[model samples]
Target: MAFIERYSRRTRWFHAGIYVAVLVLLATGWWLALGREGRPSPLARVTGLADTTVHLWTGWGLAGLAGVAVTVGVRAAGTFLVESVRFRRGDLRWFVRWPAAVWTGRFASHDGHFDPGQRVANLVLTGCLAVLIGSGVGLAFIDGGIGFVVLRQIHRWATFALTPVVVGHIVIASGILPGYRGVARSMHGGRLRVETAKRVWPGWLHRTQNR
Candidate 1:
């Protein structure tokens, strides 16, 4: 019945802020990208701004939040990047067993803060965000040249690619999956039941205990 810290308080705040900013950016970006010409975007109507202006400011907000996230959690972010890339002994097995675990309400145990799937997801999401931010900055500030055109294309493609991944991540992490029920609290309150942690991440639990 004991609980263990899964995310620190600062980490939770960072996650919440980044999540909100990303959602706003996505909403504004997609409205501008997909809305029919001569039709007002719903988001723009609600915000009382031009769609292009909303998208521009939301992108800037996301960039500012990213800066704050990196500044406040640089050490943790570095540790996460290092851990995410290092392969562990059971990572392959965890991946192999993931499908069965998802359907059968079972889970494979693994070490570290992220499992293999999560590690891969983190890397992919990070790459997409980096592309979006970099290209967005170029589009906002650079003159209308070939470089700007290239950056715009990159931003458009990356935005489209990231949409599904983000949706899937939310669905899974929000505990809509049977076995994962209650797992979402780990991010909100920075804690998880010891039993659940042991069941889902025994290696990580053991490491934490040893520390």
Candidate 2:
């Protein structure tokens, strides 16, 4: 029945802030893209700003937040980077067994803080976010040129690509799947029962304890 420490307060705060910003950006960006430039959704109504304005400011804010995280929460950022980059033996087996594990409450063991799937998720989400931020900034700063048009198109496609991946990540992290039940609490300074932790992330638990 023992529990292990998972996310730190700072880590959790940054995580929540970043995701909230991304969600806001997505809503505004998609609304503007689908509607006329002057038209805005209720999400835009609440913000009391034009959709493009909201999206632009939010993107800048996210970039600043990321900078702050890297500077102020350097330790946590480093740990996350190290963990996400790590790949170890048995990782391939973990991915191969992931489908059945989704409903079986049994996950294959592998090394490191992140499972193989999570490492892939980390890389993908990072790439998408980088593309989003880069293109968003370019679109916001540049005006009336082919470059701006190109950036806008890139941002559009990046949003299209990121949406489903983010949704899937949400589904998994929410622990709605049978195999991941009780796993949701591991984020945001929460913990999991020893058994639940072991079942879902045996390698992480082992590494955390041993380290």
Q: Of the candidates shown, which would achieve the greatest TM-score relative to the real structure?
A: 2
| Best candidate (score: lDDT) | 2
Lowest summed lDDT window (length 10), candidate 1: 31-40
Report the Cα lDDT for residue 4, model 2. Answer: 84
- Cα deviation of 21 in candidate 2 (Å)? 0.5
Off by over 4 Å in 2: none
Compute each candidate's TM-score over C-alphas. Answer: 0.91, 0.93
What overall lDDT goes with each candidate model? 0.80, 0.83
Which regions of candidate 1 are displaced past 4 Å? Answer: 35-38
Q: Taking the tens digit of each residue's C-alpha lDDT, what string does model 2 give over 1-211?
A: 6888777776677788998998988788778778766876787788788877888888899999878867987887788878898887768889899999999977788766777888888888888888988887787789868998898889889899888888888899888999988877887447677787788778778878889
In model 2, the Cα lDDT at residue 63 comes to: 94
Quote model 1's TM-score: 0.91
Clashing pairs in 2: none
For model 1, what is the alpha-carbon lDDT of residue 84? 82
